[model samples]
Target: MDIRIGIKDSAREIAFDSAQSPKEVEEAVVAALDSGHLTLDDAKGRRYIVPSAGIAYVEIGSESTRKIGFVA
Candidate 1:
């Protein structure tokens, strides 16, 4: 799944791909916001952490299969 995190005062948002489910991601975000910190592990084993207060919003993209080549 593709996740986009909007940071306060930043023009560019953080984007990453995670293997976790949408519900799990949402829960984690909510938990982090409530606790003042957000941490997430991506499918590639990379960790992302940010202050919940600094987060403007979180956009969760739908999981889609990668397509190659052009289709008529």
Candidate 2:
């Protein structure tokens, strides 16, 4: 799934593809908002941690099946 995180006062948003399910992502965001920060791992294994206070908006894109190779 494609996730876009908007930071407060920032022009560009942090975006990445996560291997996590929608429910898991939602849980993480909710926990972060209540706890302190948001943390999620991308499909590449890189982990992202952002302060919840600095989060402007969170855009969760619809999950789509990845296409492989060319089609006729």
Top model number, lDDT: 2
TM-scores for candidates 1 onward, in order: 0.90, 0.89
Candidate 1 at residue 13, lDDT? 95
Candidate 1, 5: how far from true, in Å?
0.3
- C-alpha lDDT values of all predictions: 0.94, 0.95
Instruction: Give a tens-digit lDDT track for model 1, residues 6-61.
Output: 99999999999999999999999989978999998888999999999999999998
Q: Which residue pairs clash within candidate 1?
A: none
Measured with C-alpha atoms, the lDDT of residue 27 in candidate 1 is 98
Question: How do the residues 1-72 of candidate 2 rate in per-residue lDDT, one tens digit apiece?
Answer: 999999999999999999998889989999999999999999999999999999998888889997899988
lDDT for residue 20 in candidate 2, whole number 0-100: 92
> How much does candidate 2 score in TM-score?
0.89
Regions of candidate 1 where Cα sits further than 4 Å from its true position: 68-72
